[model samples]
Target: MNHPLYGYSLCAALALMLFFGIYFLTARTPDKPIFSNYLRSRRIMGVALLVLAANYLVHLLCELRFSHPDQAIFLNLSTYYLSAWLFSSALTSLLDRNYLCRNRFLRHILGWLLFTGVSAVVLLLMPAGIPQFIGLLIMAIWFFVYAFRLARRLVRTYRKAVRIVDDFHSDHIAAYIRWLSIFTYWAVVYGVGCGVLTFLPKRYVFLWVLSSIPFYIYLFCSYMNYLLFYEQVERILESEMECKPDTNLPDSEDTAPIGHLTIPPKLTLWLNGHGFTQPGLTIEELAEELGTNRTYLADYIKTTYHTSFREWITMLRLEYAKSMLVKHPEQTVSWISEASGFLSQSHFTRIFTEKESCTPARWRKLKD
Candidate 1:
């Protein structure tokens, strides 16, 4: 109670949570579905921010009023558990807007409230001995269960999103997924740490409050960054398809036989003419250019190239870069990466090294 760090950290956390709560809660977004979904997710920050800020405020009040602030321990545990749930819900919306729209989400919250409400009763009723410890232990275990579920779900979402994104875009999409992966790992770590620390002696809860600053900041930054990236990608896709009919929409013609939709001859010619070297090229754009459907183009690439559209394009780009490396040894890797249709030179080098087991510069020198 007398610790200087406790007061400072409590004040800092209160300010931050209130600020973030108001900012994200009131932040305006476009009317589009994608933007609206993100707005919904960001708004979760407001609820969580308010709950967590209130918890900290209570802690502050207790510390100031009580000669001993022992009763404030439950605040940290409850805040951590509920905050994790809110964080997971926000991310779940971004990945799948339809997820948890049913009874499961409600059940989970009800279960948390039930257990937490019980634990609080036990803690306040019991005379600060074994019974209180038992209550804390149960709360910690309950958190572990929920944390495990969230960790598993996050991993599953990461894997599926990576697969879909990599197969859909032939550009710098790796950067989007990389950040997602980092955030996923950090969320798991933060959850597990909080769960374990929840059972620790209440005197050490200043650590929990201090640690929360980074957790919330990192999550907010990551979510906003991802949302911005998603918006940029959406704008690019929209611009590419602007003024063109949305041919991919389902219709009776869509189910019609695709047998006559053999790979277009122009596809081969286009590939040979450096068509795949266009940065940010998508299967839809290529299909539109070829006067074919993305389905046919994707199937053709899968069958003939024995790879996804993205992988086929990437391999073609790699070959182009390799040839350029040999033919024009003086040209920089950056230039070759751009000419070869990569959105980023670092991305080019990463893919090149992954395939060849050597960097572009070394591969060029070795081929000499």
Candidate 2:
């Protein structure tokens, strides 16, 4: 608080955290029943953010109250350590509640308390320089360890989320998380910088703390963009609910399941009729076209085809593209990609290279 810049920064952080806390708490949760857990997560996360803001507020207050504010260093570091753990939980909640379930949250609280208790003895009782140095070293180590651990969890959870979307959808859910990758990379940098600043003077720490205002702003924006993907997830859930199987009688499709994902007669006919050559061929759309339901179609594709609905559709598109390449030598690859149901030539080429181990242009040349 002695420094005007530091005072302004703390006030700014307080406001940012307050805004984020309220947004997460009051934001409209997904209306779909399947997302109840996610809604619960948001509420818990909002509380965590508010707690973090309180940490900043305490710092500001202590700096103002005590002529020798360093007398309150223990209080400052203790609350920050507490807020640090909660902050990780808050971000994890944004990803998935399961990552920090009740058992996990309790375990984290216990560990934080145990560590804080032991460190308090050092900070409060030990001689001057020893306490500051050792306390900081301990806090820095803990912060780095947990921050790295949470970063890994974020990446893993994000990848799984993308996979889940692709498992059932052929939409552009991949786009939702593309910018999220930028945020993840920035988070790693922020963690490293903050951990280092833990050892530095308060001035440098305040400067870095100020960085969090924009960091979180960018992060929240990217996260909100993910709601578009959630909408698709809600649709899938709705389809599952509406198309739930009946126990009254066995499903005729279940009785005589196709072997090895043999294209069912109807799908075979549809394929022959070039139904797979249309862009945005989601499983729900395919099910509707087949006069079936989404759940049954998803199960059929997953169990028999040994691939996700997204990959299955992509494979079909590539096959169609290959044939088109062979027959229409003059047509551009871009034209073939769009004609064969891909979003773009680049997307088509990427998938082709991944699946075929050659570029579409090279493949066409070899075929010619």
User: What local lDDT score does residue 168 receive in model 2, on the 0 to 100 scale?
Assistant: 61
Candidate that scores best on TM-score: 1
Instruction: List clash counts for every candidate, in order.
Output: 0, 0
Question: Which residue pairs overlap in candidate 1's backbone?
Answer: none
Instruction: Give Cα-based local distance difference scores for all models.
Output: 0.74, 0.70
Q: Candidate 1 residues 188-244, lDDT tens each?
A: 777677656655665676686788898778766776677658775444334434523
Measured by lDDT, the strongest candidate is 1
Residue lDDT tens for model 2, 1-368? 47777778889999998998899889996677756655665566677678768777876776632454444445555565665566556555544544666788788789778776766766666667975777767865775676577667777766766666676666555566566557667867876776566567656657866988998787567557666565555455445444546565345765535422444777889989988777777776887888775556777778768888888888888899999999999999999999998888998899899999999999988887
The estimated TM-scores of all candidates read: 0.81, 0.69
Over all chains combined, what TM-score does candidate 1 have? 0.81
Q: How many backbone clashes does candidate 1 have?
A: 0
